[model samples]
Target: MKGVDLLDLKKIVVFLPGRLLPADCRETKFHVSATVGFIHIVAAHDYLGILDKLRVPDDVRLYFEYRELVLPQLREAGVVVEEPDIMVAFLSEMDLPEPGSIEKLRAFVQDVGGFDLSYIMRDLQSHIVNPERSTDYYRIMEEFARVPRSIWREFKRRLVVSLEASKAGTPRRPFRFAFPMTDCTFMVASMDPDWPVIGEDGIRMRTNAVELFTQAAKYDLKTRIGVGLLISKVGDHFLLDWCLIDEPWSANAKLEDLLSTPLFGPARERVVDSYHFRGDNAEPGT
Candidate 1:
């Protein structure tokens, strides 16, 4: 009989018993369950290799492969719509603060007399250079200016995500597949499996899945999709459900012509990729 050699051509190591210990052990780490929201998307065509990465379900895959055969009328329906940017010079009279620091933005907000920074900037650049400066507006600006820098930072991050859609080639609405307008499916997906809750206030707080997803996609291309609020249930506390849907079609006439779209299946998987490194919103473990 040959001698049994467990180490033949294999590296040996001690198995740590601690890892196998149950959560009930005093010495074992406490596992906190939390829910996270995720967006489910599948384009009519995945020229960008996104569909492969998403591992869309067999139904979605079949739809994409044979879309032309299945729905010939939609072949010429898609159009590249561009909103050209209008150029305008700012008024020389007003001093604009660079959005480099929160304090500077605050001061600028106070000077402008309101929280409508975009509107103020628009006025500065547009033909109509002033929008009736008033004390009431100034008071409102002051009130908003008093808010902490942390809140402002989050606002800035969201603003950046919103502006990214203005870039060239960004798709506009009704991200169509074979699905009809009424076939627009809404599914709840958990984006983060281990997101922490800041106690009772987590229920009241809302997370912007679009901003988060846009930031994750690095604005390489805009997602012609919408997101519902991240909702969490009490107890076990390990799930955040997000409403996911493609862009809505405004024309009521064509809704009847749409086909059924798959909203759920094995195509969904957890994306562990972090969004922190992409931009200035550098909070870790997000």
Candidate 2:
């Protein structure tokens, strides 16, 4: 950021506010901002957490120092693209009106696309859809009508694929469309509402990560559970970036069937290896 121009950095941040899955953005609305202070802080975190996580394979460790740090640093320095009002409008369209309300948040989780809305119908059903000769069955259905069982089943398939991918060198890339992993052209995430988005001209930003995590879990890929993703280029060399965010739960948390994947480990090395990803270009990878 020392050598980078502030104008360029702002552009990068405005372009890629990673769509948050539901649980992550719950109660939170997308708020676009371009305060210099905020940008500086975010860049620091990238230097600390994200950069530290990248593993320069023993073979390329020495040779890749420049590209590894310079490119990201440039993006980090130039992340102030959009104004705050635009973000407010974006949040309005998404139905996320400020934070702190569960009802509005739940409706948003159901309406949104990707993983956020996918699991709502299913999760709600699991809690209520019972044939027991009881009255609570109806009450449960009335109360928890967010996740549908069918969507959960689809999410289960993805979970299975992720588990299998963990065993294989290539983890099955997650996307909303039916495109192959190698065809994807974009990679993004969100931690706080103020996170940035990415582009060639600007540094990529993470938008509404809390919802992203929720959506990831609803779909069963559990990106938030512990997996940081890497996006590479091969077929056409389009979007060759990736993301690895925070871990799910904690070490002390008990293992459950919902979180049975192999996407977590020594951060840097894992992202480096996974970074070999080549988006299918026709699909979306996040």
Candidate 3:
């Protein structure tokens, strides 16, 4: 399905946080005349694994239990209730090169388009000015100037490898929302909590985000589900960002806020019907 047009699908499944629907509803399915969200091309293994993991009755129940039980404890202890450090798990599992190993760093740098000091500095500047900028920005900048370029590049590459490994590794408790549809259950996996839906300016979507999702669609199509994207203004063009796929717990609230925006007014009209199902205990509502 090369160049698969999202409009071609007669019916599409939209996975939304269950909290958005009626309290008693456990499953729902409906139709929309126009696209409701960004079309992201995700790997089958990634998404299907989430679906399979979620469908297990024990896992599903345990997920809710963990949210209620462990998350608050973590928050009380000043630990963020987000995805675990799968990278640390990867490091434990494999004998990867140390961050200070220059030989391994050189190979990694070449593999990742090589090191460009100018580009790195520009990226650092962008981060420093970002509204949600990192607190360690000043320290990082100070260290960048003090350290040799090669050493700095090596450290950055190590972070990149760690992040990539984290993504590939299975989360001890994956973040996801399940919508048990009539025919099948559709799952929406959460992206990193740190990812900004809008740019630092607060209105536009980040250019890198647009490029990432668009490029992701080009690979495998077997696991491809229909696309649902959020439109954001980028310079003169409106770009797409994956929707309802942000942090699972807050996605519904985010979607609600987005729909109220002037840019999303058209999407509201296109959403024809929304249904809520309560298994066989009650009638589904439209």
Most accurate candidate by lDDT: 3
Residue 156 Cα positional deviation in candidate 2, in Å, after optimal superposition: 10
lDDT value for candidate 2?
A: 0.28
Which candidate number maximizes TM-score? 3
TM-score per model over all chains: 0.18, 0.16, 0.19
lDDT of 2 by residue, 115-201 (tens): 232232343322221224344333323212222222323333444444444334353434331112212111222122122324432
What C-alpha lDDT, on a 0 to 100 scale, does residue 80 get in candidate 2? 26
Provide the global lDDT of candidate 3 against the true structure: 0.29
Residue lDDT tens for model 1, 1-286:
1346322221112223445656444221112225421112222232233232212232223323332222222213432111010000011111221222332212221111111234322322121102243332332233223332322333333333323322322322211111112232222223232433345444223244323332222111223332222323344432332323344334322222321233222223222211122232443323
lDDT agreement with native, every candidate? 0.26, 0.28, 0.29
lDDT of 3 by residue, 245-278 (tens): 1211223344345334442111111211111122
Q: How displaced is residue 151 in candidate 3, in Å?
A: 2.4
Evaluation by lDDT, superior candidate among 1 and 2: 2
TM-score ranking of the models? 3, 1, 2
Any idea what lDDT model 1 has? 0.26
